[model samples]
Target chain A: MAEFVQLLVSGLATGAIYALAAMGFTLLWQTSQTINFAQGEFVMLPAFIMLSAIKLFGLPLYAAFGVSLLVSALLLGFGFKRLLVDPMIRHGVLPLVIATIALGIFLKEGVKLVYGAEALPFPEALPQGIWRFASVSVTVNDIGVLLLVFAMVLALQGFLSRTTTGRAMQAVAQNPDTARILGIDVPRMITYTFLVNAALVSVAALLITPVYLAKFDNGESIGLIAFIAAIVGGFNQIRGALVGGLLIGVIDNLSGAYISAAYREAFPLLLLIAVILFRPQGLLGRAEERRV
Target chain B: MTRWLLPAAVLAVLIALPHGLKSYGIYLLSLWAVYAMAAMGLNLTLGYAGQVSLAQAAFLGIGAYVSALLTVNGVSFWLALPLAGLVCFAVGILLGFPALRVQHHYLAFVTLGFNALVFLVLRNEEWLTGGTYGVEGIPRPSLLGLPTQSPIGFYYLSLGFLVVLSFALYALLRSPWGRAFAALRENPTRAESLGVDIRAYTLLAFAIGSGVGGLAGAFYAPLVEFIDPTPFDLGTSLALLLMVVVGGSGYFAGPFLGAALVMLLPEWLRFSESLYLLLYALLVMVLMATCPSGLLGLWAQARERLSRRRPPPPVLETRT
Candidate 1:
């Protein structure tokens, strides 16, 4: 039971990061009808930027993180949507998909060229050490990540429900044509969606890099996990993405522990396949009406 | 006049080009042909049928491993090749069932998962696949008492298969089935309304495309004289997709040019060493942004401007 508790805590921490990434992914999908294949690389690149801000520019950790997030928000968020997605998206989803895949390769190769291919150690942000209770131990980092992500989710929920822009973004997601007819700026809302997504993923990158370490290729696995989590949780629901992420995190950890560790990566994918086969809309997703 | 002249000139070049080249050059050409075949298969599914699959590499890997395991154990390469294709066809059909339920992003996700699953199997099944050690020493097949052990000989063999497969695909594309695929891609609901069996065609699109990929994989195993999980990973799948997209997906000869560009451009750009991939990716991105229809699309546009005549139907449309 203690071991299970320990695994559960760690898994939730990992799941929190996945949840953050999934929310970003779902946000983009809902607003733009885009499936950003470069999402993993997007999340991965910000961590490297943060690292460089600290090491090369000699900035303090907090300042470096702020710079990194801002850069990512401006360049990856705005720059990506404007340059890559907007132009190709009008042609078809396939072109956009292919472009994003290329973007992923570009980001990965660019990072490799600039940052070097090695995994760099990330500075710990959370207070170090573990807390033991009733023969169960949990790291403060895990606790800190969970708390941060939970707060962020709540904040995002409040913003979406309460704010004019956030509600406009939600309106754009529901029906872009209808939203535009109602005087909402659909394109601007989409841009804001990308911006919010970039910020959320930036936070995920900061939180995750401490545990996973900053690696050039971390995006591939993390991206896949995020996609799975979003799909499992329900692509349309923000809360579903969170729940799905936590579920995947727990399942991945438990399976890695109780099942064969050799196939840890494959297990989540199998679950994804199962979810896709049986529940195409996802666990929390409603069945979409087929339109001609 | 231009049609006959173009193909004849191209054929003459293909035949004459290998003799002047060294062994490594011949190998690269053979690799191009092999990859072109796989890309062609991917084009049929993604470009023609409008189905997005990232599992072509998984099918290719399946074909390679199946053929390699059989041939290394004394089965004829001839028999092993078709058997490999058959296996992929069956698997593709099974995967197609899930595809029936999902569309666009969900379908791509499913296929991506399928690719990962296949990679895990290839990596972990060490007793069968030799794991990361890879299966090596795959002997080239004999063609009617002719030993294709030499690089030139294998190049000709690969070229021959490329020709045969191209002819077969051309015939298939001219048939009624091809029209169905085109219709399905253009608008599936409309096609279904017109009494086209979208479900069967969807499965066939996957099965035939994957079968061709498997056939290409059969060649790939002997061409490399080895098998491993590395080349069969998601990278190769993406690369194959790149070939189709870069060449002009719906165009019949798209994969041929795409495979060449994707395979050879890096070698030509080797002067940049590590920066070659970055350059290549940048080029692809620029092309996608400016003209998502690819090289053929640009060519078509150029032709349209010069002739000022009714142009062929474009690959790009507003159809979602």
Candidate 2:
């Protein structure tokens, strides 16, 4: 029972990051209607930037994280969408997706060229070690992850429901044409959406890099798994992404703990395939109507 | 006369390609053939069928491994090639069941998952694939009692097979079946209304596409003289897709042009590893932004412009 609880906690911790990434991915798709394959790369590159800043200037975590978020939001996310993504959107979804994939390789390779291939240890942010409750012990990082995610979710809900900018973004997401006619600057809103997405993922990277170590391909793995999480949660529903990400994270931990270690990688994918087979729309996703 | 002239000229160049080239040059040309053939296969599904499969590399890997194993055993390379394609085709069909259920992004994820699964299996399953070391000692094919041991002979052999299979693929794409595939792409509901079995045609597209990918893999194994899990990863799959896109997806010659550019450009760049990939990625974005239609599209645009600028030739009206 203790072991199970421990696994569950760790799973939830990992799932927290997955949820954050997935939510951002869902947001991008919701507003943009384009599947950005490099969404994961964004999650990855920002963390590296933060780490590089920390190393180069010896800044504190908060300062490094803040700077990284700004750079990613301004230069990578906003600038990238305005310059490249918006134009590609005119062509169709496929080209945009492929362009993102190329961007993914570019980002990953760019980091590789700079940092070399080895994984670097991120500076410790949270207090290390465990808190014991009977036979169950929980790490501070795990607790931090859960709290951070919850805070972000609550904040996102508030922003979406209560703020004018968030509401405008939501309106654009629902129908860009209608929103455009309503005199909302749709393109600007979309770029803002990307900005919000970059900020969310930057937070995720900050939380995750300490646990996993900063690596070039960190974004690729999480981005993909989180994508599965979003799909499982029902891609169209933002809330569903939260549920899907947690579920995947828990499943990942449980399988790694209880199942054959050698086959740990296959478990989430196999689970995803099974879930998709039964729930084609995902756990929280509404079924998309087949168009003629 | 003009249509035949282009093909004839292209063929003359291709046939003369291996001659006067060093062994490495021949190898690069052979790789071009592989990528071109594989990109053509991917185009059949993506361009014509409107399905986005991110698992082209997995099928290509499957083809390579199967052919590698078969040749390592006493089977002829000749026999192994089709057999490899057949295996990939069957796997592709099996994959179509899950694939056909989803739409858009979901479909992409499914193929991506398939790629991940295939890659993981290749890495972990040591007995059959020799794990990370990869399967080496893959034998070359002998055709018509000719010794294909030499680099030139092997290059020609691969080229000959590529030419034949590509023409066959072209014919297949031009057939009534191809028309059905096109109709599905244009309007699936309308195609279904016309009594086209959408599911069957989709599966058929997967089958044909994977078979071609497998054919490329078959050649890939012998040419590289080894096989590993790296080239079959998602990046390579994306590269294959990029090649088709960069070449112009829907056009027949697009994959060929795209493949040649992708495979040869890096070698021509003197193999500055980071520089080549960086340029390739930049090129993809620039191309996507400026000319989403790809190289073939660019050529068409140029030709259209030139013809427009030139004074119109006097038209002779033929009375039918």
Candidate 3:
């Protein structure tokens, strides 16, 4: 029983990070109808930024985190508007996809050039201790991550449901033309979505860096996993992202524990293929009428 | 007469060029031929059929490993090559079933996942794939009784394959089936309404593309004399796609030119080392921005303009 509890706690902690990443991905897809292949790089860049701030500038941990989030959000928003979304307005889908992929490659190699393609230890900030109960124990960082994720989720929900801008964003996602007619600036909304999503991803990166260890290439795996989570949950659906992240987290943890660690990454991909084959609409997604 | 003259001259140059170049140049030429073949396969899928596949490398890897294993176990190169194509064809058809049902982005995602999965399998299946170390010591292909170990011998062999494949592909593209693929690309719904079997054509395109990719991989394994997971990663697949796009996807010779330039340009720029990628990225952006029609398209446009300006040949009144 205790072992199961331990697994559940760890799974939820990792799932929270995935959930945060998925939120950013879902937000981008929701507004733009394009998947940012560079989404993972957003997570990776912030962690690197935060680490640099602490190690080089001798900044306080909280200040470093704030600076990282702000810079990441600004950069992502700028790139999306200038490079991807704007060009996509005139070109076809392929160009947009290719552009994002180019951006991803550029970001990846740029980071590698700066960081020397090596993983670095993130400065320890979380309180180091564990709470034990009935042969089961949970670390303080794990608890902190879980609490932080839940708080962000609640705050996001509140913002979306109650705030006027948030409602306008949701309205735009559903029907951009109608929203535009109703006085919502659809392009600006899309840019705002990118900013908010980047902010959320940066927060996830800041919190999870201590657990995963920061690396230039880590974004590829995290972005891939977040993509799988979005697919499993159904693209463009917030609730689906949450459930999908948790489910993938549990499956990943269990598979690593029971199966060989080498096969752990394969599980999510296999699951994605199966879901795509059998349930293209995803677990929680609504089926749309096929055009052809 | 002029068209035939140019083509014949080009072919002669290609055939004789290897004799003058160094061994390294010969190796690079062979590699370019193999990549050109693979890019042509991708063209059928992405260019003609309008489907984006991120699993080209996976198919290539499958072909390489399959042929490598077969030849290393003493199977004839001729036999192993065909077998590799057949395997990839079957896998392609299987992949095509789900692929045809989804939209473009979803299909791309599935292919991306598929590539990742293939890489994972290659890295983990030590018993079969030789694991991360990869399968090495693949035997060089022999034609009839002649050994193909010498660079000169391999160069001719590669050229022969390239000529035969290109002709076959050109004929295939000019066929009714190729027209159907083009029709599907332009408008799937309209094609279906016109009694075209969209599903069947898409499946055929996938199978043929994978078969071509497999064949290229088989040749590549012998040329390089090694098969590793590195060469067949997602990056390779993306690079192939980039070649097709940069070369002008719709043209028959577009992918070949694209592949040749993309592969050879890096070699020519090897002195720059680290700056090569940054320059390449800048070049890609410039090309995409200024010449969306690609290099082949640009040439075609220029030729049309120049010909338009020239006076029509004096009407020689055939009094006789």
Highest lDDT: which candidate? 1
As for model 2, its CA RMSD to the true structure in angstroms is: 4.6
Best by DockQ: 1
Cα RMSD (Å) per model?
A: 1.7, 4.6, 5.7
What candidate 3 gets wrong by more than 4 Å, as runs, is A289-292, B1-10, B291-293, B297-320
Per-residue lDDT of model 2, residues A182-205, tens digit only? 999998888888888889889888
Model 3 sits at a Cα RMSD from the real structure of 5.7
Docking class of 2: acceptable
State the TM-score for model 2.
0.93
Model 2 Cα shift for residue A57 (angstroms): 4.3
For all candidates in order, the CA lDDT equals 0.88, 0.82, 0.80
* Model 1 per-residue lDDT at A231: 89
DockQ of each: 0.68, 0.46, 0.28
Q: Sorted by TM-score, highest first, which candidate order results?
A: 1, 2, 3
TM-score of each: 0.97, 0.93, 0.92
lDDT of 3 at B219: 91
Worst 10 residues of 3 chain B by lDDT: B311-320
- Winner of 1 and 2 under DockQ: 1
Compared with the true structure, what per-residue lDDT tens digits does model 1 show for residues B1-320?
A: 87678767887899899999999999999999899999999888877877778999999999999899899999999999999999999998888877665655565778889999999989998998999999999988999999999999999999999989998998998899898878887787899999998778876887899999999999999999988899999889988988998898888888999999999989988999999888888888888887788788788888888888765655454232
For lDDT, candidate 1 versus 2, the one ahead is: 1
